[model samples]
Target: MKRIAILGSSGGNLYNLGGKEPLKLLGEIETQASSAGIKIAAIQFIGAKASMDNANESTLSRLYTWNSSEENIVFSEEKALKEVNGEAKKVDSIIAKMIEDGKVQGLVLMSSDPEGVNNLSIKAAAKKDIPIVGTGGTSMATIQSMGGKVIATSGTTGTTNRTRAVAAIQSLSRHWGLKYKPVISSSGKSSQNLDENIFQRISFRGIMMAAIPGFIAMSIVLALSKIPGLAKLNDAFDLLIKGLPVVVAAIAANQVSGLDEVGIVAGVVAGMLSIDGGLIGGLIGGILAGILAFYLIQLALRWNFPGTTANIVAGGLSGLISGLIVFFLISPIALSLGNGIRYIIELALNYNSIVAGAIAGLLIWPAIIGGVYHAAILPIVLLEMEKTGASFLGAIDMTGLVMVSAGITLANIIYPKQKSESAIAVPGFLINIAFGTFVEASYPFMFSDRLIFIGAILSAALSGVFVGIFNVKGTAYVPSVTAPALSNNALGFTISMIIALVSSFLITLFANKISRNKRNKEA
Candidate 1:
């Protein structure tokens, strides 16, 4: 067994956008390691990502003691800063202990822009000459400037950086002749494949930074479309929401897939062609345009005349050629598909509010578990938010998450005997729900505690009805605590949250009481 520690800030001062994305990174690594017959000795996190606000005494004590745990309970941002002079002693001690105990062999630092000082372990690892892997250009630059001995440094794909980290460590392990079972590898996914290796993962992120203006344009409209009595402007806003993602994605894709420079003009062309396609059309058009432009640029580069302006000329020509071909050819099909998808979703939502919420709650888990839910509905939610200023379906799904968390918290209060489990799942899940808008914490309980699962779904449906009744609105494809609180419908969101928590608590308590009675009867 060998291990590497992943450390980072709270993702560029926010919770999920930067380092915290690819929420599935750890699980993917674990599965790969398990199949390869390698054991991950420990995966500890440090810094702001591990912090909790106004944490209870028990969690605080663990932070104070710096006791290690598999979960995030043992670390705290405040504790790290206030108690340790902005040093990463907890991180250092944890890794040092693991290495001393022959548990882990290396460290991989998930990077942040501007770099975070939460892990002073770079100097410590360098002193011991341990291999450290780092991500993010800014962080990697700092590591190099400081002469740290990290074996590798590169940009990470926002979605799949975890795999990169594990692969890097495995590369390090091979140098040491570490014995581990062989895992089947995917074809064309090795470090040498340009598309999978360098382009999508590293280049896409770098290029996307240039699309910030386009992003803000799309973002503000999603929020503004929620304003009341703006029906006349709905069509125009719809076009913006539908068009902008493509505009940004196209330019980004061109850089990632081809020419090595973002093409803003080409993106605008793709956007204009996909006027009413919303999120889905934008994604499809952008990706298509990128691929087309890439090949076109490749053709242009064959001329081989060297000049500083060559890239720009080649890129612009490719954009025009690709944009014209893609939009004219695919626009019709994209529009139909977009409308078809929207119609199906609207049909489901048009059902009774309670029924709609219940349907969404019941279906959400399966969709999430299968992983198709994100691809299928993110566009609809975003488009709906853009057109009507709300997504009842999205809200319904989110209400269930918070409700389940609150229920578990409430159950712990009523049933002290369950304190151990409660301590593990309560705020941990709630924090994710708030920050990442993730709702996976209680999913494991489906097999272990059927009653909890059922109660959570139904109770969350009730809260979803609350969302429907009040017409609660969210600003984006994902639902977060911040979205509603910052929305024009703040009061509705507040009430919906309260209803969700109380409803979930009561239902869970009732379910538990029934289970107890059934056990007593069986006895």
Candidate 2:
């Protein structure tokens, strides 16, 4: 079971701001958590004495009751000074210990007072890579600013604390693969804004969420099929690989549809019909179908149609409309687009592999930092993989993106500007080399110093030249250590990674030396 700790001030804010009884809100959270297979391992209350004294009597009584009766709930109370400056330290220490003991996997934060619960606990959790779900304006904004594996249940402003709390549980439940109906307020309204932009509704994070499961399934099946006893599973592996588009479409549509069942049905139908257009068509069709179904369901509801009737109308109309549109209008266009891009890339490779590789390597870091890599480059890479089962661009990603990150982070460990910097660098380097997926591990160092960033991109370009000259191409988004074996030219891939690592490392060392000298001069 997943374990979590709830940390925040008392319940006075909930009742005051949202007109919600604290006990009732907690009950809703408990029900959602139970459905999601999550356990509330601990709850630590932190607030100034005045706030604690002002807390709802029913809420305090229930907390005492839970502490008295529940074996699973570890409860603690920390009373801070009236100024609230030291409110989070005691709670942070408790959480840090719990994290060290592996008793906590996630955090739930609720605090309306910005000054009461500072970044102490947040930094503690972020350092250990624990996911945090925050409710209340101050808590949500703090988590978002820190930017590591955090979820804000509502926008930082304009939402009631109770709404955020309810939404937080729902988000957590959905994240853990459970279907919990959204909590509707007594006013017959939903927390979600129906008029939110379509583009904003289509989440890149959700798209990645769609891609990861299929990728993992294919990876596991492919690996297992190589065993002698599992040779028959090769057909199953192939089927999974070929059906990737459908899986991506279904999940993407579900996310775009706000997890509506009707939207998911529409997505599946659209995905099936758009199979001829490959992953791009499926993705586009799924998003379109979800949008159509979402609005249709809302319209039906507005007209006061019966729930079942609304679902049937939305699902039937969306499925038919999206499927036909994809098949007749979108498929041919998507196919042609994919083919044309593939042809241009192939031409570049033929004309001068080194130049193509260098250009791609040099530009990739900018794309990623600018947050355009997913929308601009990922589709091209996916299309390349669908058609050829291998991609030169994928090779560049492994060397330029993944290996370069390992190098930059490792340099920070070896030549850190401070001991604290080195302490963080150690985990970043290990995570980069071991998992090879989290390029953001190097962000601390990259964002701190411009020299390091420049060195990284230059080293990546050089490494790309190595791969291009040796014609190395293979799978992407795997550990760099294993990437060589998967490549067409293992020796070439290995050399490319080495070039990326060593060049960036040496450049970082030089950059650090210059920075220290400048600091000394200023002093």
Candidate 3:
């Protein structure tokens, strides 16, 4: 059979080898198995005391060389031990004896330690033309430099590559009869971001420039949260809902001028109408307005209302009723939380943006599926004010109004095309509802038709730009459709939301048409 030998040099004293170190021995054994067509006959020398359970021993084990039957296998010397060249020579001598005994076919080295036992082992292995397999601590970088076969453990420091490698190997093992296991390891995280301290050191300008820190943050969350607890919380749907109201409201409010006022009034009224809302007027407004809009649209559609007619009725009626409640009831609560935008901003700045983003992404998908509009994102934002101060809510409110304005504008562009024909489930209506209730619902539709979603993202980003540029602020805990009433340059937020909505809706319609055309052609 294929017979190859590995000389393993570890940091631990050469006394007792068992458990994890055996696995390294097993690794070489398997390599030998591939070289020859037989099972491993002997394991002559392994780091006896290399405790995989302990760091010191493990470190020592990885840094020395051992030999079996004239084959010298090397493990890299730890940088800390580089000064101890004499002690390293003793380990190399032990490796040479095993090789001379003809116990193995070829020698394998685990790493390159220039001045220690590992270096000597390499020299010995080369003299005999023994195939040497070597790897380093940084497998990707070191393997490339050394031009040797490299295998690293999953969840290691270089997590992305390690994950990719594990996935590839697992897939290969499943499809073929190959079994590949990792030799290095860390806690089972697929990826990690910069340390907290490093992240904290970034300039405010850098944070702003990295505008979509959400992008990187979301990706990291996706990677790490593979397990149940972390995954569910870090889910994209959850992130989407966190800031959905501010985002959607900012887009929808501008569809019709009165709507923003109506939204604000609704917020105020909802706050006063219910004891809970009165306690947190802005958040209550977002929820009530969402619920009101949802029921109104459903009722109008059920009554055989025309599309355009239904939208106008739904938008006006919902906004007006909600506004009245908010103006009288919620206004008092908002007065205490913050007199104006300044209060909301100062109080709410401490809310976790990453968590908010994750919640928003997570909720977007389900909301779309469930036909809930953009209301899902409101609560998280409303709560954010409590975390930051009270002024954060005001900012959230202004943002929401801007989003609504954008949504309305988008609806106007797309609705006209599909107005005459009824769809089983209207795309914009579905997206709106999903955003309000189950934000995750947005993903399916977006993924199903990427062409449409890309347009939506671009529009939304443009709207976000306006938000950034205009520095719009509101006076409530959550967004109000009436942001135009509160801010100086709210028109930009309104216009951008319109752009996003129109783009989203139109793309959906276009995608649907294209899909239908292709299906018909195929049929």
Candidate 4:
């Protein structure tokens, strides 16, 4: 039978606000699980003595408690608050163990707070590819942020909490192919229709997270290989670079399958086969493998097959099929597309470097915001680096995008309409200049003023012209301050960055002055 775990904050906002009995919630969950043919393998109550008391009172089997109390079993609000961090860690550990041992295939979470314990548990389940249904507080919002499904609710009353929780559980049950009756809210609307798609299920964030380590490793190896004894390491690093597609595929598969072992195995096989197709092929193959393995595993569970036998069948079949399809059908096409894109980019750069750079710089902002950078541009950057040892496009991103963002934030600090906003910009500016990451610091300023947004993009394009004229090229996604040293023309790249910074700063300063004047006039 499919097993699930229910985790909740005891004596917290859920209980404090609604004055609901925890026992009744447990009973309701059990009732739904019984009707859906799912087993409640474990229930964890997190908080203080009230949680321990609830755990003890729970008639349901396999009850666990992460209480703040040590010797005494009395609930203390202060104690629970003090031990919040420890309790959250314990919750994460327990859930991770349950997922690792395959004791639970799904999770039900109810919490009033979005952070602390709830966030940790959601992360653990996400890492393991377990389905989660949540209610109360910001539980649904948090789950949705991680790209999980949610059933919306209108209020935070005890009845609404129970209704949403039951509906979410019923929805999860239906997803798993169990016999489930749709739960309807007081408005007579089926809870299934209330589900919202806040984020894509594919998880581009996870893909980028997985790819970063490989890029960092490649950068480090390339930088160190120049040292006398590290000459041989270049060959090893080259091999590692070639296997980047496999790395990306493995992580993509895990994200897609919530770390299903069978799905992961299939994804690895597909990625290996799609080596010729580059990162693009591996990504596609891994996604296909994960999807195929997930459905096959579900079918096996429905048929009551042994777990080991089911995993073997699903992994073997999915891997073979996905690998074969990628190798014969997809790889050639992917390779051609990748080469064609690279050829076009090279042609553009050759035809008119200034115009090409300006266009790329102008489009980079929208692409980064629109989720196209990781899905499209990043692979091309990696491919370019693999072939040429550096990327011109990478240089443009560092100078035009990264430097320009830093410049705008710096401008805000120098000419602040409000000191509070400038103080906030300090950290963002430092981070951008120091580590060359998280251009989002400039976002608030850009979003607040249309002129600043337009000025930032135009300034970046102007900087890109300088980068193109100087023929600057470097490793992408590195610390901006240090990025210049990695470029083909370090001095020229530095000049390009300076141009971007100064131009954006001047533009932002002008915008800030205008805004300040307008605010004064309004006052």
- Among the numbered candidates, top lDDT falls to 4
Clashing residue pairs for model 2:
none
Over 1-523, each residue of candidate 4 has an lDDT whose tens digit, in order, gives 8887777654444554332455445545655565566766666645434432253432222223423234111222334333554544566667667777787788776663346555555566666777776555455676767765443322233232334344556557667877654221322123222112111446665675567767656666766666689799789778876787787777776556532445567788878988888777887778777666656655654454433445665666776778778889999898788688778888888999889888888888888878887777776776666554567778877887888899999998999768888998899898888887778899999888898899888988887888789877775567787787666677888998999899989999999899889999999
Global fold similarity of model 2 (TM-score): 0.61
Overall lDDT per candidate, in order of appearance: 0.50, 0.66, 0.38, 0.67
Give every collision pair in model 4.
128-258, 129-258
Among these predictions, the greatest TM-score belongs to 4
Off by over 4 Å in 4: 1-200, 203-209, 227-229, 369-375, 517-523
Location of the lowest summed lDDT over 10 successive residues in candidate 4: 190-199
Q: Write the per-residue lDDT of candidate 1 for residues 1-523, one digit (tens) a residue.
A: 5555555533342234233432334443444444434455544443342322332223212121123354222333345334432345455566556665556666655553223343445555555566766455567677666666666554543223323433444445555566432122332122223334323433433443354345435445655555687554556666665556565556555444433333344455555555555544555555555555444433432343222223344345545554555456765776677567657766765656556666666666566668655555544555455444456555655566645555555564565224465666666455645553445555544445677777776666667777766666543223355557434467886677767777767766666667667777998
Q: Whole-model lDDT for model 2 versus the true structure?
A: 0.66
TM-score of 4: 0.63
Q: Using TM-score, rank the candidates from best to worst.
A: 4, 2, 1, 3
Local accuracy of candidate 2 as per-residue lDDT tens digits, 118-175: 3555565667787777655545675666764664343323233333444565556656
Q: What is the TM-score of each candidate against the true structure?
A: 0.51, 0.61, 0.25, 0.63
RMSD of 4: 14.0
Q: Pairing residues by index, what is the TM-score of model 1?
A: 0.51
TM-score of 3: 0.25
